[model samples]
Target: MAAVSRWPENVVVFLYAVFFFHTFSSAQRDPGYTFMHQATTAPIVSYYDYIIVGGGTAGCPLAATLSQNSSVLLLERGGSPYGNTNITDLAAFGVALSDLSPTSPAQRFVSEDGVVSARARVLGGGSCLNAGFYSRAGHDYVRLAGWDARLVNESYQWVEKVVAFQPQMKQWQSAVRDGLVEAGIRPYNGFTYDHMYGTKVGGTIFDQNGHRHTAADLLQYANPSGLTVLLHAPVHQILFNNQEGSKPKAHGVIFMDANGLSHRAYLNRGPNNEVIVSSGALGSPQLLMFSGIGPKEQLDAHNIPVLLDQPLVGLGMSDNPMNAVFVPSPQPVEVSLIEVVGITHNGTYIEAASGENFASGTRTRDYGMFSPRIGQLSTLPPKQRTQEAIDKAVEDMQALPQSAFLGGFILEKIMGPVSTGHLELTSRSPNDNPLVTFNYFKEPEDLQRCVDGMKIIENVIESNSFSSFRFHYLSIVTLLNMTASSPINLLPKHANASRSLEQFCKDTVMTIWHFHGGCVVGRVVDHDYKVMGIDSLRVIDGSTFRNSPGTNPQASVMMLGRYMGVKMLRQRST
Candidate 1:
């Protein structure tokens, strides 16, 4: 009685033509606003002098600057990067990061020590899955986050006058800006976005025909009759009230939509109504440790209900540790991604990205500019990691030879390492995915500053103005043999090849995903980004970054959502 197998009629007609073009396609677009669909039951406006929660990249410029005089809302849990084309096609950036589907505006995840990323479930979060490099936010990170260096340069020119640009530098990003001034990384300041120190040329959100431009196109400065947004919704918590202990405010949120129902909204009672969040840095500390706020014994070991012990809600996480050096090129260049940046006064930040015409059934040919040791060799389980140690590291990275010009370079150390990491709560399900660690190189001076940023990318590939490309420095100790049982001496006939290049930087370190501190600012938000003991709440993106600003944090997270929407419209007009 257990024999009903079937399927192969051309795999059931290619699974009914992929469920009839994803159930009769043509829907998702509309970022125009007044948008709805949390499976529409209408009613929803219970209040909202401001709400916001994650339309992403700092909730679409802080809900289009608090909808120009209050009444906002926003919401957004994916769906609507206005006409997706794998997010408006900038060479379909590896088909929007290898589309893991669930409506893919790049949401993959993975972590518990197996580090795989891809965050941004649409609505321009991580500027719709990053690489649209833009700089600024390093005047010692605005005098160590005391900000207001003239309103952070007027919120970096109001998000660089609608999603920045100025790139056009081809030929392998002008040989990585003349190999970072032939690796001396000196004064070639040029086209600045001002993080200064050396070879520049920043700002880019793709335009000039490459086409990206997100942060939901800054909701074209909202106020569409005081914004509303909604989309697939999803919030699921943060509706606090707490009386017996005083302080707990954040009066409303619950969420769920896209036909999962549940709604709620709230906020407009007064005293400057609030709720911000801008979900990022692993979703604003996993939605503030799933609303009860964190570390009260990891939110009572995930049984949840704490309300606010706030042990630094998801602690000081930090990322930016990259180290790639691929270089294939034999001809076909163009098709790029970050343009000319080298910043290094000994804290390394060099960058380069051009993967030449890669749109053939994308996974961008298993795009590996570091960070994919199959999530660190699938963190040990899987029958104790056999399968011939993952097919001899994928046959030694597919025995090299396959290139129609493949140049890629990323060497980010992004400032002296102080190493910090944390973010917990494995479950209490706001749709799970939480435990991220980034304890990368657990501070041995962050593996000698990522082996001094891989000897400044081996001195920009032994420059001579990058001698007409043609390259090959695979080496992460021959691409991860990791200097066979390293008991010292690691090549250059050892005289301490910097302790075998710090054990080949602990087997090729990763994450240049520039993740900032988890709800940080003076540790869980304060310096005007609110959230500390939670009242009207706040968090305006890059998880209120009190640290990672050495560079590429999506133009300092859209200048912290336009400097917290001009300091919440000057504290709601006083």
Candidate 2:
């Protein structure tokens, strides 16, 4: 077990929040978000010992760790996430989207299979948008990845010491815990970061003030002299030297600035100098495909030069298929985020959040997702309320009647889904979203797992632990177990299924946004995470993951960055 930091909890809530804001705004002092230099300001050419693509959840930590001893260039396509309440404050759900930055962090996309999902386009990546749940990857994951166990523990400790915190459990979350236990998940493993089968209160990245501490916050540990972070710099292509009788070597990358100006950054002349792609699952594969490293047939279709015919580059794509139900609370539920999780043995995970709004934890009754509340608006002065936002709010209010106000969400997502799909490039543009389809519940086992999970959820809703929160209908008999009138039923009466339970799972299928794969180990990359058939190139993000590890992948992804960095530094010394 890792030595869990006994760092004083009360001190961190305000200390880190204030520290991050003060240190980040100076814009030139640290290798932090405030030190964000626009790509246009960069020279037409530059050199670094390491060029890291994607300053995301894993990228940020990886680059920060590498910068301890080597000159590193970190490039992010999106802008900073410093002052955005929509992204930062846990209680404030989707208030409004600002034109504050030229690029917004949430890049919305619709997959080929007609499922709507959004990829993070900001510096902290999905960590800025996730539920902030933190749990270690399972023991099986460590053995399978062939990671050094002692170093893995140390890596997790390093990140936890800086970012992860024990959450102050809230009302809705507490009830969820009891309900999970009531449903017979297992013995409670209270207040733990270790992944275990049973109800457990895991660490959270959100502080007591409801402020989010993301993977980007880990940059505080970076060496300022050795790191240069560029924002709004999307890579166009990875420049490679493909000489005959040698493996293709990644030399540099071409990236576009916010001004749409192109710039080049190259790896310096050193045997160990490398270009690492830490872009998320989707972005990493897409970038490789853009740089002529995918299937030969797909490259020919786009007229791209084939650097490597790595057919497995964009294969084995899977998403933990998620299904959720809105539990309408008769009384106003206090705004709460995910603090409790149930690790069931049947390959299913149950977690939940409460709020008045569409974002994680909100409490409200009468507006669309973007509807601007007068009270919330009044908190800010007149100038802070942009005309665009008011107009958007008006538009939302007009569309408000069609939308339903949610009390809270209790969700179940299958872990390590057996049903898989693939990702294909949509166009040649690096920024264009590729076509991805998870084919949710396509396999019989997957469908059966979801159905079984839903049954557990139904048990949770009816359990004695949730009696206070449960809505009692004195007038009509509440038929929770009946197929005809289940409170958890989201599907129409006539949807195709052997029963309404399976139909409910099918109709309400959604993405928890835990999509991983495309560049999996043993297939696209080797055991060491170095890309096969290529030199001086490696992928260290969720793209290489065969599955989203633990309750959430953020902790493991961040840990992998630090762990690999330590390993590489040791290798260099030897």
Candidate 3:
């Protein structure tokens, strides 16, 4: 035995040395380096503890959060990851990525048959491609819409933590801030946890590491365990059992993968199994109706066989319509995000005390914060203090310092009059995308408010402050449709003379991508985020927001997804 050991000693040492060297070399190499392998076979049906539909703004977060402890199946209709410099960093440069052509696949769909839908369809969903603004909505809007302060506040905190939403390091630009100040519209950091009205001035811009923030950062950073993020998997219809009851209980979902192949999966419901819908406003409702959970009349028309008589499923589609009246910048606005955040807290607190000035009645809500007043405005008498506050806010915003270049602006016209829109199934073929119409400016007051908002912007641009900047107006072709031109063109036009004041004001209607209230809380899902009238089903996203919050909705949606994930986990624990 001693003689044999001596002979093998050198051989063992050599093998061990070679193994260590290979392992060390492998670890030192680039992590992303891999032999590219083409996906040859289409993936067949797979089961999971949780199934989340949509890969957009809300869905991505939901999947990332839920899959933290358990397996999650995230399905997106768009292609694989295609990261661009602008899409990953600058918030202002995201929309422009669409022009990259050939590389930026069309994740959006066409509604009204001919009209294109601006919703994202890829893996990171809309977050991968949204204007990386992390604006929080006013608390009042959440409470008014039946959500308690506890839930809303928790949601806010959850989102801020997950996304690490830092305010702009520097002020957006003194010109825009000063212009608002000139308008008597005190700039209030709109993301403040309180008031959305009153005599305030200035606000914060959301950014990430000196660049514009996106959900991709959060999801990738979190790195949920046992989660499969499969892009190009568009859900066609939810499979439900008719005999279950009035509201059909969803059995599972059917989707189309990247190769246009059909696949299906089933959910067991409760305990380990749960299904969630975070498919944004348009996609969520369409999924419901196709699965037999919408207005009876509409469902029957499309031969979807009603599962739940949810008239409100797709009836309350809402979006912020803006008349972005670009004013000439003395110089191109080139402030970095780090510089922007540095000023947000300073700006928010500086004007916090003025929030109460816009209060009406008991002043139960924060006045200085950006509140969603349009929902309540219609109820206020034309002479009431609430209406007065809106008017004053609009007036002040118009007169803001460098009002034309204040980074971004919000006015009454953008809130809009509440109007109904349809999300009807385009064909019995559930694989196709549903039809959507925003029906902007449905009410006479809405049109009038737009005119007023535009007039204010026009007045601000023509003001003495904008004298040094070059300007142009939106093209006639762009005005007729929101999807006609990329959002890239949104800032080009500064001169009112380029288009008649009436044309610029009347024709220009743009979306802030703040769609909400389609699958509202009460009508579609319970406050617990569970789908009403269905078992083992839930909705957690902007689509579940019963009403439009008073500001950017990304924070709120992310919060809701987190809340739902935590609650579901806790319930399972018991």
Candidate with top lDDT is: 2
User: Which is the better candidate, 1 or 3, if ranked by lDDT?
Assistant: 1
Candidate 1 global Cα RMSD: 21.2
Candidate 1 lDDT over 295-374, as tens digits, reads: 78887887888888878877777776665555555566676777778887667677877664344344334343231233
**What do the candidate models score in CA lDDT, each in turn?**
0.69, 0.76, 0.51
CA displacement after TM-score superposition, residue 83 of candidate 1 (Å): 34
Cα RMSD of all models vs. native, in order, equals 21.2, 8.5, 14.4
User: 515, model 1: CA deviation in Å?
Assistant: 1.8
| lDDT tens digits by residue: candidate 2, 1-574 | 1322455766666777888976554322233344468787888899999999999988888888888899999999887777666777666544323222336577656555544456788788888777778999999989888998999999999999877889988677788899999999888999999999999999998876667788888888888888998988999899999899999999999999877888999999988889999888899999998999999888888888999898998898988877665565655666666788999999889988775554333433432221243211211222234445445544554464422343466778888888888999888876778888888878888888887777777778778787676576511112212211324443443343446657666655656678999999999899888999999999989999988899889999899888888877777667
Candidate 3, residues 1-574: lDDT per residue as tens digits?
A: 5765777778878877988865443212222312111122335676778888876666766766776677777776665443343344342232332232423533344334122235655555566545444555665566665655676677566556545453442323334444444544444343343334422222222333433344443465334455666665667788766673364566678877556677887774455577788777777887887778888988888777766787878866666554443223334344332111111211111111111112222322221112222211111222232435545644544454542332222232344235556676677553455677666666555565555554444433344443444233533233322211223233234444433433433334444456666787777778777788887788777777644554445666666666567667666677
Using TM-score as the measure, the top candidate is: 2
Residue clash pairs of candidate 2:
27-34, 355-361, 355-362, 356-362, 356-363, 356-364
For candidate 3, the per-residue lDDT at 385 reads: 27
Off by over 4 Å in 3: 1-43, 80-82, 91-117, 162-172, 187-195, 198-212, 220-223, 242-247, 269-272, 335-413, 428-433, 455-504
- Which ten contiguous residues of candidate 1 have the minimum total lDDT? 374-383
Clashes of each: 3, 6, 44
